[model samples]
Target: MRLRNKPWAKELIDAHPELIQVQPEHVADQFAQKQPVRLEIGTGKGQFIFKMAQLHPEINFLALEMQHSALAVLLKAQVDAQLPNLQLVVANAENLQALFAGWHFSEIYLNFSDPWPKTRHEKRRLTYSSFLTQYQQLLVPDGVVQLKTDNRHFFEYSLISMNQFGMQFQQLSLDLHHDDTTWAAANVPTEYEDKFSAKGQPIYGVRAVFHQAKG
Candidate 1:
Protein backbone atom coordinates (compact mmCIF):
# COMPACT_ATOMS: atom_id res chain seq x y z
CA MET A 1 0.00 0.00 0.00
CA ARG A 2 1.49 3.27 -1.17
CA LEU A 3 0.97 6.13 1.24
CA ARG A 4 0.75 9.73 0.20
CA ASN A 5 3.85 11.74 1.03
CA LYS A 6 3.17 13.73 4.19
CA PRO A 7 5.21 16.86 3.44
CA TRP A 8 4.93 17.92 7.09
CA ALA A 9 5.86 14.49 8.39
CA LYS A 10 9.58 15.24 8.81
CA GLU A 11 8.80 18.51 10.62
CA LEU A 12 6.30 16.77 12.87
CA ILE A 13 8.82 14.05 13.67
CA ASP A 14 11.52 16.64 14.35
CA ALA A 15 9.26 18.44 16.81
CA HIS A 16 8.42 15.25 18.71
CA PRO A 17 11.66 14.04 20.24
CA GLU A 18 9.77 12.01 22.83
CA LEU A 19 8.05 9.87 20.19
CA ILE A 20 10.35 9.52 17.21
CA GLN A 21 14.09 9.29 16.56
CA VAL A 22 15.35 11.64 13.88
CA GLN A 23 18.89 10.33 14.09
CA PRO A 24 20.01 6.76 14.67
CA GLU A 25 22.97 7.64 16.86
CA HIS A 26 22.83 6.16 20.35
CA VAL A 27 19.49 4.52 19.55
CA ALA A 28 19.67 2.36 22.64
CA ASP A 29 19.86 5.42 24.90
CA GLN A 30 16.22 6.23 24.20
CA PHE A 31 15.18 3.18 26.18
CA ALA A 32 17.93 3.30 28.80
CA GLN A 33 15.44 3.42 31.69
CA LYS A 34 13.31 0.59 30.27
CA GLN A 35 14.19 -3.07 30.28
CA PRO A 36 14.00 -5.62 27.48
CA VAL A 37 13.44 -3.59 24.35
CA ARG A 38 11.02 -5.09 21.84
CA LEU A 39 10.78 -4.17 18.17
CA GLU A 40 7.95 -4.40 15.66
CA ILE A 41 9.13 -4.29 12.05
CA GLY A 42 6.70 -2.85 9.52
CA THR A 43 4.50 -1.32 12.16
CA GLY A 44 1.77 -0.25 9.78
CA LYS A 45 0.10 2.92 11.03
CA GLY A 46 1.37 1.86 14.51
CA GLN A 47 -1.77 0.26 15.98
CA PHE A 48 -0.03 -2.95 17.09
CA ILE A 49 2.98 -1.20 18.63
CA PHE A 50 0.75 1.35 20.33
CA LYS A 51 -1.38 -1.33 21.96
CA MET A 52 1.64 -3.47 22.81
CA ALA A 53 3.47 -0.56 24.44
CA GLN A 54 0.34 0.34 26.35
CA LEU A 55 -0.04 -3.22 27.61
CA HIS A 56 3.65 -3.74 28.43
CA PRO A 57 4.95 -0.51 29.83
CA GLU A 58 8.04 -2.12 31.29
CA ILE A 59 9.27 -3.17 27.86
CA ASN A 60 10.22 -0.31 25.59
CA PHE A 61 9.02 -0.61 21.99
CA LEU A 62 10.73 0.67 18.83
CA ALA A 63 8.40 0.65 15.88
CA LEU A 64 10.06 0.65 12.42
CA GLU A 65 8.43 1.45 9.14
CA MET A 66 9.56 2.61 5.69
CA GLN A 67 6.78 4.97 4.78
CA HIS A 68 6.68 8.57 5.92
CA SER A 69 2.88 8.58 6.11
CA ALA A 70 2.80 5.64 8.45
CA LEU A 71 5.55 7.10 10.58
CA ALA A 72 3.75 10.42 10.69
CA VAL A 73 0.52 8.84 11.83
CA LEU A 74 2.20 6.71 14.49
CA LEU A 75 4.48 9.49 15.72
CA LYS A 76 1.64 11.98 15.90
CA ALA A 77 -0.41 9.57 17.96
CA GLN A 78 2.60 8.90 20.19
CA VAL A 79 3.18 12.63 20.67
CA ASP A 80 -0.49 13.17 21.56
CA ALA A 81 -0.58 10.24 23.99
CA GLN A 82 2.94 10.84 25.32
CA LEU A 83 3.69 7.14 25.49
CA PRO A 84 7.09 7.09 27.12
CA ASN A 85 7.46 3.37 26.50
CA LEU A 86 7.12 3.75 22.75
CA GLN A 87 9.36 5.27 20.03
CA LEU A 88 9.43 4.99 16.23
CA VAL A 89 11.78 5.13 13.23
CA VAL A 90 11.17 5.55 9.55
CA ALA A 91 13.48 2.84 8.23
CA ASN A 92 13.34 -0.36 6.24
CA ALA A 93 13.78 -3.79 7.77
CA GLU A 94 16.68 -4.54 5.42
CA ASN A 95 18.87 -1.93 7.06
CA LEU A 96 18.01 -2.86 10.63
CA GLN A 97 21.62 -3.64 11.53
CA ALA A 98 23.05 -0.28 10.44
CA LEU A 99 20.02 1.51 11.84
CA PHE A 100 20.42 0.12 15.36
CA ALA A 101 24.24 -0.09 15.33
CA GLY A 102 25.20 -2.73 17.96
CA TRP A 103 21.92 -2.53 19.90
CA HIS A 104 19.86 -5.66 20.38
CA PHE A 105 16.25 -6.41 21.19
CA SER A 106 14.74 -9.03 23.48
CA GLU A 107 11.91 -9.74 21.10
CA ILE A 108 10.95 -8.88 17.55
CA TYR A 109 7.49 -8.82 16.09
CA LEU A 110 6.55 -9.22 12.44
CA ASN A 111 2.90 -8.52 11.85
CA PHE A 112 1.27 -8.78 8.42
CA SER A 113 4.48 -8.01 6.50
CA ASP A 114 4.42 -8.20 2.76
CA PRO A 115 4.48 -11.77 1.45
CA TRP A 116 6.60 -10.84 -1.59
CA PRO A 117 4.96 -13.78 -3.37
CA LYS A 118 7.53 -14.67 -5.96
CA THR A 119 10.34 -17.20 -6.08
CA ARG A 120 12.82 -14.55 -7.16
CA HIS A 121 11.68 -12.26 -4.35
CA GLU A 122 11.79 -14.86 -1.58
CA LYS A 123 14.84 -13.27 0.02
CA ARG A 124 12.86 -10.09 0.65
CA ARG A 125 10.52 -11.88 3.09
CA LEU A 126 11.07 -10.88 6.70
CA THR A 127 11.52 -14.50 7.83
CA TYR A 128 13.86 -15.44 5.04
CA SER A 129 17.06 -17.14 6.17
CA SER A 130 19.32 -14.14 5.49
CA PHE A 131 17.11 -11.87 7.51
CA LEU A 132 16.85 -14.56 10.16
CA THR A 133 20.64 -14.47 10.46
CA GLN A 134 20.52 -10.71 10.93
CA TYR A 135 17.79 -11.12 13.51
CA GLN A 136 19.87 -13.72 15.31
CA GLN A 137 22.72 -11.23 15.54
CA LEU A 138 20.39 -8.53 16.83
CA LEU A 139 18.65 -10.70 19.45
CA VAL A 140 19.75 -11.47 22.96
CA PRO A 141 20.35 -15.07 23.99
CA ASP A 142 17.10 -17.05 23.89
CA GLY A 143 15.44 -14.05 22.31
CA VAL A 144 12.46 -14.78 20.08
CA VAL A 145 11.11 -13.62 16.74
CA GLN A 146 7.33 -13.78 16.66
CA LEU A 147 5.30 -13.56 13.50
CA LYS A 148 1.63 -13.23 12.66
CA THR A 149 0.29 -13.22 9.14
CA ASP A 150 -2.88 -13.90 7.16
CA ASN A 151 -0.89 -15.45 4.31
CA ARG A 152 -0.50 -19.19 4.72
CA HIS A 153 2.27 -19.54 2.15
CA PHE A 154 4.35 -16.89 3.88
CA PHE A 155 3.81 -18.50 7.26
CA GLU A 156 4.84 -21.89 5.90
CA TYR A 157 7.90 -20.37 4.31
CA SER A 158 8.81 -18.77 7.62
CA LEU A 159 8.57 -22.13 9.37
CA ILE A 160 10.78 -23.73 6.75
CA SER A 161 13.32 -20.94 6.91
CA MET A 162 13.54 -21.04 10.71
CA ASN A 163 13.76 -24.80 10.73
CA GLN A 164 16.56 -24.72 8.17
CA PHE A 165 18.29 -22.09 10.31
CA GLY A 166 18.16 -24.46 13.33
CA MET A 167 15.99 -22.14 15.43
CA GLN A 168 13.63 -23.66 17.98
CA PHE A 169 9.92 -23.22 17.64
CA GLN A 170 8.73 -22.04 21.03
CA GLN A 171 5.12 -21.65 19.88
CA LEU A 172 3.06 -22.29 16.80
CA SER A 173 -0.56 -21.60 15.94
CA LEU A 174 -1.86 -22.37 12.47
CA ASP A 175 -5.18 -20.75 13.07
CA LEU A 176 -4.96 -17.93 15.56
CA HIS A 177 -8.64 -17.02 15.24
CA HIS A 178 -9.73 -20.55 16.10
CA ASP A 179 -8.50 -20.47 19.70
CA ASP A 180 -10.28 -17.44 21.09
CA THR A 181 -9.21 -18.06 24.69
CA THR A 182 -5.48 -17.65 24.03
CA TRP A 183 -3.81 -15.42 21.42
CA ALA A 184 -7.03 -13.61 20.66
CA ALA A 185 -7.09 -12.16 24.13
CA ALA A 186 -3.42 -11.22 24.11
CA ASN A 187 -3.18 -10.07 20.52
CA VAL A 188 -3.46 -6.43 19.53
CA PRO A 189 -4.71 -6.58 16.00
CA THR A 190 -3.10 -4.49 13.26
CA GLU A 191 -5.20 -2.65 10.67
CA TYR A 192 -4.68 -5.48 8.18
CA GLU A 193 -5.40 -8.12 10.79
CA ASP A 194 -8.76 -6.56 11.70
CA LYS A 195 -9.71 -6.34 8.04
CA PHE A 196 -8.69 -9.93 7.31
CA SER A 197 -10.28 -11.38 10.45
CA ALA A 198 -13.51 -9.59 9.72
CA LYS A 199 -13.51 -11.28 6.33
CA GLY A 200 -13.10 -14.72 8.04
CA GLN A 201 -9.44 -15.21 7.22
CA PRO A 202 -7.44 -17.07 9.80
CA ILE A 203 -4.11 -15.74 11.10
CA TYR A 204 -1.04 -17.93 11.51
CA GLY A 205 1.60 -17.35 14.15
CA VAL A 206 5.01 -18.62 15.17
CA ARG A 207 7.53 -17.85 17.89
CA ALA A 208 11.04 -18.98 17.00
CA VAL A 209 13.87 -18.71 19.48
CA PHE A 210 17.38 -17.95 18.24
CA HIS A 211 20.08 -20.38 19.29
CA GLN A 212 23.08 -18.55 17.85
CA ALA A 213 25.19 -16.41 20.18
CA LYS A 214 24.36 -12.75 20.17
CA GLY A 215 26.85 -10.46 18.46
Candidate 2:
Protein backbone atom coordinates (compact mmCIF):
# COMPACT_ATOMS: atom_id res chain seq x y z
CA MET A 1 0.00 0.00 0.00
CA ARG A 2 2.94 2.26 0.64
CA LEU A 3 4.27 3.89 -2.55
CA ARG A 4 7.24 5.89 -1.31
CA ASN A 5 9.78 4.11 -3.45
CA LYS A 6 7.93 4.21 -6.76
CA PRO A 7 9.91 5.91 -9.50
CA TRP A 8 6.89 7.78 -10.89
CA ALA A 9 6.04 9.08 -7.43
CA LYS A 10 9.56 10.37 -6.93
CA GLU A 11 9.40 12.05 -10.30
CA LEU A 12 6.06 13.67 -9.45
CA ILE A 13 7.38 15.01 -6.17
CA ASP A 14 10.36 16.49 -7.94
CA ALA A 15 8.42 17.87 -10.94
CA HIS A 16 5.54 19.76 -9.39
CA PRO A 17 5.98 22.59 -6.95
CA GLU A 18 2.23 22.79 -6.41
CA LEU A 19 2.25 19.29 -4.95
CA ILE A 20 3.52 19.86 -1.44
CA GLN A 21 2.99 17.94 1.78
CA VAL A 22 -0.34 19.04 3.20
CA GLN A 23 -1.98 18.59 6.57
CA PRO A 24 -5.75 18.32 6.94
CA GLU A 25 -5.91 21.56 8.94
CA HIS A 26 -4.70 23.73 6.09
CA VAL A 27 -7.17 22.85 3.33
CA ALA A 28 -9.92 25.45 3.70
CA ASP A 29 -7.66 28.43 4.09
CA GLN A 30 -5.40 27.15 1.37
CA PHE A 31 -8.10 27.30 -1.30
CA ALA A 32 -10.33 30.14 -0.17
CA GLN A 33 -11.07 31.33 -3.66
CA LYS A 34 -13.98 33.26 -5.12
CA GLN A 35 -14.48 30.61 -7.77
CA PRO A 36 -16.13 27.33 -6.88
CA VAL A 37 -13.80 24.65 -5.49
CA ARG A 38 -14.31 20.98 -6.27
CA LEU A 39 -12.56 17.94 -4.87
CA GLU A 40 -11.99 14.39 -6.09
CA ILE A 41 -11.23 12.10 -3.13
CA GLY A 42 -9.50 9.30 -5.02
CA THR A 43 -8.01 10.55 -8.27
CA GLY A 44 -6.66 7.39 -9.87
CA LYS A 45 -4.19 7.96 -12.72
CA GLY A 46 -5.57 11.53 -13.10
CA GLN A 47 -7.46 10.87 -16.33
CA PHE A 48 -10.89 12.05 -15.16
CA ILE A 49 -9.85 14.99 -13.00
CA PHE A 50 -7.33 16.13 -15.55
CA LYS A 51 -9.90 16.24 -18.30
CA MET A 52 -12.37 18.00 -16.02
CA ALA A 53 -9.86 20.64 -15.01
CA GLN A 54 -9.02 21.23 -18.64
CA LEU A 55 -12.66 21.46 -19.66
CA HIS A 56 -13.61 23.80 -16.84
CA PRO A 57 -10.82 26.23 -16.36
CA GLU A 58 -12.84 28.54 -14.17
CA ILE A 59 -13.40 25.97 -11.46
CA ASN A 60 -10.67 25.09 -9.00
CA PHE A 61 -9.85 21.47 -8.25
CA LEU A 62 -8.23 19.59 -5.41
CA ALA A 63 -7.33 15.93 -5.95
CA LEU A 64 -6.56 13.78 -2.92
CA GLU A 65 -4.96 10.37 -3.00
CA MET A 66 -2.95 8.44 -0.45
CA GLN A 67 -1.30 6.22 -3.03
CA HIS A 68 2.01 7.68 -4.07
CA SER A 69 2.10 6.00 -7.45
CA ALA A 70 -1.32 7.26 -8.44
CA LEU A 71 -0.56 10.74 -7.25
CA ALA A 72 2.62 10.70 -9.27
CA VAL A 73 0.82 9.73 -12.44
CA LEU A 74 -1.68 12.52 -11.92
CA LEU A 75 1.02 15.03 -11.17
CA LYS A 76 2.92 14.07 -14.27
CA ALA A 77 -0.18 14.64 -16.38
CA GLN A 78 -0.80 18.00 -14.72
CA VAL A 79 2.75 19.01 -15.33
CA ASP A 80 2.57 17.93 -18.94
CA ALA A 81 -0.73 19.72 -19.47
CA GLN A 82 0.40 22.81 -17.53
CA LEU A 83 -2.87 23.01 -15.69
CA PRO A 84 -2.98 25.95 -13.28
CA ASN A 85 -6.29 25.21 -11.58
CA LEU A 86 -5.41 21.79 -10.25
CA GLN A 87 -3.80 21.02 -6.90
CA LEU A 88 -2.69 17.64 -5.61
CA VAL A 89 -2.55 16.27 -2.08
CA VAL A 90 -1.36 13.02 -0.62
CA ALA A 91 -3.74 12.19 2.22
CA ASN A 92 -6.50 9.90 3.36
CA ALA A 93 -10.14 10.84 2.77
CA GLU A 94 -10.89 10.48 6.50
CA ASN A 95 -8.65 13.43 7.34
CA LEU A 96 -10.71 15.83 5.22
CA GLN A 97 -11.99 17.80 8.22
CA ALA A 98 -8.50 18.36 9.55
CA LEU A 99 -7.34 19.50 6.11
CA PHE A 100 -10.15 21.95 5.47
CA ALA A 101 -10.28 23.81 8.78
CA GLY A 102 -14.08 24.04 8.75
CA TRP A 103 -14.21 25.07 5.11
CA HIS A 104 -17.01 23.92 2.86
CA PHE A 105 -16.27 22.70 -0.64
CA SER A 106 -18.68 23.44 -3.47
CA GLU A 107 -18.66 19.85 -4.70
CA ILE A 108 -17.04 16.52 -3.88
CA TYR A 109 -16.50 13.68 -6.33
CA LEU A 110 -16.08 10.06 -5.26
CA ASN A 111 -15.27 8.15 -8.40
CA PHE A 112 -15.08 4.40 -8.16
CA SER A 113 -13.93 4.32 -4.55
CA ASP A 114 -13.02 1.03 -2.90
CA PRO A 115 -16.23 -0.92 -2.22
CA TRP A 116 -14.95 -2.89 0.81
CA PRO A 117 -17.80 -5.32 0.04
CA LYS A 118 -17.56 -7.64 3.04
CA THR A 119 -20.04 -7.01 5.87
CA ARG A 120 -17.29 -6.58 8.43
CA HIS A 121 -15.61 -3.95 6.26
CA GLU A 122 -18.74 -1.91 5.63
CA LYS A 123 -17.61 0.78 8.04
CA ARG A 124 -14.51 1.31 5.97
CA ARG A 125 -16.57 2.12 2.90
CA LEU A 126 -16.46 5.83 1.95
CA THR A 127 -20.23 6.10 1.93
CA TYR A 128 -20.56 5.14 5.59
CA SER A 129 -22.16 7.63 7.97
CA SER A 130 -18.83 8.36 9.62
CA PHE A 131 -17.31 9.43 6.34
CA LEU A 132 -20.46 11.34 5.43
CA THR A 133 -20.25 13.24 8.71
CA GLN A 134 -16.69 14.28 7.95
CA TYR A 135 -17.74 15.37 4.47
CA GLN A 136 -20.68 17.32 5.87
CA GLN A 137 -18.34 19.41 7.99
CA LEU A 138 -16.38 20.46 4.93
CA LEU A 139 -19.15 20.98 2.37
CA VAL A 140 -20.87 24.28 1.72
CA PRO A 141 -24.61 24.61 2.06
CA ASP A 142 -26.21 22.97 -1.00
CA GLY A 143 -22.95 21.25 -1.77
CA VAL A 144 -23.18 18.12 -3.89
CA VAL A 145 -21.43 14.74 -3.65
CA GLN A 146 -21.28 12.87 -6.95
CA LEU A 147 -20.44 9.19 -6.69
CA LYS A 148 -19.93 6.54 -9.36
CA THR A 149 -19.22 2.83 -9.11
CA ASP A 150 -19.80 -0.49 -10.83
CA ASN A 151 -20.59 -2.39 -7.63
CA ARG A 152 -24.30 -2.98 -7.24
CA HIS A 153 -24.28 -3.85 -3.54
CA PHE A 154 -22.11 -0.90 -2.62
CA PHE A 155 -24.28 1.42 -4.66
CA GLU A 156 -27.42 0.26 -2.86
CA TYR A 157 -25.77 0.51 0.54
CA SER A 158 -24.59 4.04 -0.28
CA LEU A 159 -28.13 5.16 -1.12
CA ILE A 160 -29.35 3.86 2.24
CA SER A 161 -26.57 5.64 4.07
CA MET A 162 -27.14 8.92 2.24
CA ASN A 163 -30.81 8.86 3.18
CA GLN A 164 -29.90 7.94 6.77
CA PHE A 165 -27.56 10.95 6.90
CA GLY A 166 -30.40 13.21 5.68
CA MET A 167 -28.77 14.05 2.40
CA GLN A 168 -30.92 14.72 -0.68
CA PHE A 169 -30.13 12.71 -3.79
CA GLN A 170 -31.29 13.21 -7.37
CA GLN A 171 -30.28 12.05 -10.84
CA LEU A 172 -29.77 8.47 -9.69
CA SER A 173 -29.00 6.02 -12.46
CA LEU A 174 -28.25 2.32 -12.53
CA ASP A 175 -26.85 2.37 -16.03
CA LEU A 176 -24.67 5.42 -16.68
CA HIS A 177 -23.61 4.46 -20.16
CA HIS A 178 -27.18 4.09 -21.30
CA ASP A 179 -28.10 7.40 -19.68
CA ASP A 180 -25.04 9.21 -20.94
CA THR A 181 -27.12 11.95 -22.51
CA THR A 182 -28.47 12.90 -19.08
CA TRP A 183 -25.02 13.49 -17.60
CA ALA A 184 -22.98 14.11 -20.68
CA ALA A 185 -21.85 17.58 -19.68
CA ALA A 186 -20.44 16.53 -16.30
CA ASN A 187 -19.71 12.89 -17.02
CA VAL A 188 -16.09 12.13 -17.55
CA PRO A 189 -15.08 8.49 -17.44
CA THR A 190 -12.41 7.40 -14.98
CA GLU A 191 -9.78 4.73 -15.61
CA TYR A 192 -11.90 2.03 -13.96
CA GLU A 193 -15.03 3.26 -15.67
CA ASP A 194 -13.53 2.83 -19.12
CA LYS A 195 -12.20 -0.63 -18.33
CA PHE A 196 -15.41 -1.89 -16.80
CA SER A 197 -17.56 -0.52 -19.58
CA ALA A 198 -15.29 -2.09 -22.16
CA LYS A 199 -15.81 -5.50 -20.56
CA GLY A 200 -19.63 -5.02 -20.61
CA GLN A 201 -20.10 -4.08 -16.96
CA PRO A 202 -22.97 -1.83 -15.96
CA ILE A 203 -21.88 1.40 -14.32
CA TYR A 204 -23.93 2.96 -11.52
CA GLY A 205 -23.80 6.60 -10.47
CA VAL A 206 -25.70 9.06 -8.30
CA ARG A 207 -25.69 12.69 -7.29
CA ALA A 208 -26.32 13.63 -3.65
CA VAL A 209 -26.73 17.19 -2.48
CA PHE A 210 -25.79 17.84 1.15
CA HIS A 211 -28.40 19.47 3.32
CA GLN A 212 -27.81 20.54 6.91
CA ALA A 213 -31.40 19.87 8.09
CA LYS A 214 -30.62 16.16 8.41
CA GLY A 215 -27.55 16.80 10.50
Q: Which number leads on lDDT? A: 1
Q: lDDT tens string, model 1, 21-99?
A: 7555745666647588988999879988998888988898989888888789988888778877787877777867777
Candidate 2 Cα deviation (angstroms), residue 116: 0.5
How many residue pairs clash (N, CA or C atoms closer than 3 angstroms) in each of the candidate models, in the order given?
0, 5
RMSD of 2: 2.8
Q: Rate the local accuracy (lDDT) of all candidates.
A: 0.84, 0.80
lDDT at residue 163 of model 2 (Cα atoms): 94
Question: How does each model score on TM-score?
Answer: 0.92, 0.89
**Candidate 2 clashes between residue pairs 3 or more apart in a chain or in different chains:** 24-98, 24-99, 25-98, 25-99, 27-99
Query: Which residue pairs of candidate 1 clash?
Result: none
| TM-score quality measure for candidate 2 | 0.89
Off by over 4 Å in 1: 212-215
lDDT of 1 at 31: 62
Cα-lDDT of candidate 2: 0.80
